[model samples]
Target: MKKRNKFKHFLYLILALAMLVYALPLISFKEGWSWASAFGVAWSLFAFLVIGAHLHYLLGVDEEKQKTLERIRAAKLREWQLKWPEDTQRRQENM
Candidate 1:
């Protein structure tokens, strides 16, 4: 229902698909696929997993940053409210 939850679900789906794509080549290679082709596929899968791990780490960092920002923003807003109760009342009056 919430946008943030939707985004989390979408991110999970993307990661799953990426992992599946990276694994497909290995399964095919085990089924008597060409040596050269299998090597290339395996290498690509290795690279994909490495890159995916890096991206996943970066996403975690970004999520932390977002939470920190939200907390800072909320604190600032609360401070503002406490400092200017009259202003808040004035704004409500104008509305």
Candidate 2:
């Protein structure tokens, strides 16, 4: 797979692992089976923050990818125009 897709999958795996770890303590704490309330709450909050940050990062990555695609498309159009200037007029006529 592409590097970007691989990185996205890695991020998803990290998020899933984080959620599992966070929930484990919460479950144990709820069952009156653990005395790590303070630590659990702190860890859970930290995990939540990490997930939020990851979401923001993903959004930024998406925007960057879109910009890259737009740049590529524009470059291709320019190249095409240089190759076939008359095609532009034909396209305009078609429109």
Candidate 3:
């Protein structure tokens, strides 16, 4: 899963770069404006938006997993408290 995420990140980076390159013609123009230049710029803008949204989604998923782990840990700690109240109190005092 880590490898897959890394691969996906790199893939998005490469695609964004490629779109940036394609859109470069829109800025550095020796000739007059053309439909292709406009299209390239539009395409690159869309790619930027898509990549931003995808990264945001990935961040949200990670945060959700962290929240889930915290809840699980809290539940286990409560169970341990119920099962061994004195020992748990002693350990907390030691910590």
Error of 2 at 68 (Å): 15
Model 1 Cα lDDT, one tens digit per residue, 9-91: 55765775677676665555454678876776776667566666656654576678889999999999999989798888889
Error of 2 at 20 (Å): 3.9
For each candidate in turn, the TM-score is: 0.34, 0.39, 0.43
Per-residue lDDT over 14-90 for candidate 3, one digit per residue giving the tens place of the 0 to 100 score: 77767677767556445666776667667777888877866775566677888999999999989887889788788
Clashing pairs in 2: none
lDDT of 2 by residue, 5-53 (tens): 6588568758766686758644455556455766676777776676766
Displacement of the residue 80 alpha carbon in candidate 2, Å: 33
The TM-score ranking, best first, is 3, 2, 1
RMSD of 3: 9.4
Model 1: number of backbone collisions: 0
Among the numbered candidates, top TM-score falls to 3
Clashing pairs in 3: none
